[model samples]
Target: MICIMLVVAVVTTPGTSMASVKMEPLARTAPPPVEFKIQGSFDPSNSYLDQGTATISDNGNQTVKISVITEAKSSVASIGGTVYLQKWTGTQWINVGSASTISASNDWYFSGEVVKPAEQGYYFRARVVHWINHNGVYEQGETTSDSRLVS
Candidate 1:
């Protein structure tokens, strides 16, 4: 009877099978958003301009200027940037072909600026990048990406 009972138990509870169970680590913490604001820039890094409240000058053609600090001061070769210009329609703000930013940064990156839109009320931003050590090194200030507001 004991032997029969043991055989039945073994059949009912198949021994550990690797395929039968999966073990995943408990999530350390819930992930936050990648881009909370749609089509916007505000660098948590502080090296680039602030996204929330950037200065946009309406000098006929607009001009944007902002300060940035390097997180790690290193000998760099070049910088990369992603420029995005935001235009205000009657109701909402939309992007107007912010440059693809296939460009590299020279000394101008040390002090950054972007040309404003020819049309009034259009804002501009230049996400400056510093190319370092033959590597595309950059810091978007204190955020995921750098950003500025054009007037």
Candidate 2:
């Protein structure tokens, strides 16, 4: 997980490819395949992006705002597959937010508030899986981001 702040990271895959990695039976020797890749903005507005930030809110229900980057490469190709937002209960993190898959043929802007936010003072994380062409699994998936603390 090379963190230059933000890179278009490649997620876990199902089958084997030159860039494939097995996350089910994770090989201790293998490393996390997520990377903060420099992106060329398709729009004539920005030049480059270094990172992304996921802002979580705890207003009434827990909500999360993901900063999205368009015109990205295969780095984010896998990340747009699945999103599972969870919050730490007393013992374990429970699914208290959004967890679903949607179309990503286009750019996925992550700048939106979710329905349920994480619990106050609880730990939260967003799990993303790279589905191959919106299929079941990717040749590679990783829990790239760490568990963010909910406030």
Candidate 3:
């Protein structure tokens, strides 16, 4: 017997594109573990970031949806930062679009979305940075999401 599956994943930003994928046959494999804590102990006086996630889905009518999520370890008041949707351009990362956020929470979470272009799909991910006053000093931290192939 033969089987096929359709999977939609990853996020995108404005002037960027995300792709959906179709697979043939299924394989039995173990899923990877999820890590929450930072590689080292998180310091309160220092800036830290968690590489968040992105996902893309087919929105029908020749359109796709791109969604990106980023997180940081600081809740300093009047916190502000930027979320960048980047695409791997053979050698380096290039920004496709970006958005900003401000929050008063300890754990910072950002989510943004955009409609994909009609043509031209590429491998895309999300990166976020916290650049604002943190405890009377300007601190910043950045992390990138996992790369996803869009078709």
Candidate 4:
């Protein structure tokens, strides 16, 4: 036979009302190790990306600038990605403009200004997919910037 116990206590404070509180024992469970979980064929440690960043700023003239910076661990055959300018339409994010570039270097930076005549009062952000091709292996990473209101 198993027994479960519960404790009840009355708590009071100075110049305050008194309330009854119930205390119960907590049940804890250990989580499975990461290696035991089933993952896809992609290995996370094989990525050559060092850092990726995206930014959006108001240009003060009915336009916003979206920028992206992608850095790799070392010089590769090709490095580039696509930058997408997105706008929040009360419920979902929609892409407004996009730019893609490819260069043979370790670091790549790109920026574009989008005219927002129809989306003046919406929130906007920048999303970038930074990729690198090194030793016949292709790896990519994504990053998103903080949202800003287009004025």
Q: Which candidate is the best by TM-score?
A: 4
Q: Residue 54 in model 1: shift from native, Å?
A: 6.3
Clashing pairs in 4: none
Worst 10 residues of 4 by lDDT: 25-34
Report the error of model 4 at residue 140, Å: 0.3
RMSD to the hidden true structure, all candidates: 20.7, 20.7, 12.1, 14.6
- Per model, state how many residue pairs clash: 23, 19, 9, 0
lDDT of 4 by residue, 1-151 (tens): 9999999877666666544433332212222122332211223675675666667787755577666666666667667656777777665778875454534454444333333332555677677777778778888777777777655
TM-score of each: 0.36, 0.39, 0.44, 0.59
User: Candidate 1: which stretches are off by over 4 Å?
Assistant: 1-55, 61-72, 100-109, 121-151
All models: lDDT? 0.37, 0.40, 0.50, 0.60
Candidate 3, residues 60-95, lDDT tens digits: the string is 343446565545664544344455666666556677
Misplaced by over 4 Å in model 3 are 1-75, 102-120, 131-135
lDDT of candidate model 1 versus the reference: 0.37
lDDT of candidate 2 over 3-98, digit per residue (tens): 676667765555657455533321222222344633221232222212233333334233444322222233333333345676545456556545
Q: So what's the TM-score on candidate 1?
A: 0.36
Q: For residue 148, what is the lDDT in candidate 1?
A: 31
- Please say which candidate is ahead in lDDT: 3 or 4: 4
Write candidate 1's Cα lDDT for 66-108 as tens digits: 3333222433344434445555443444566554343344422
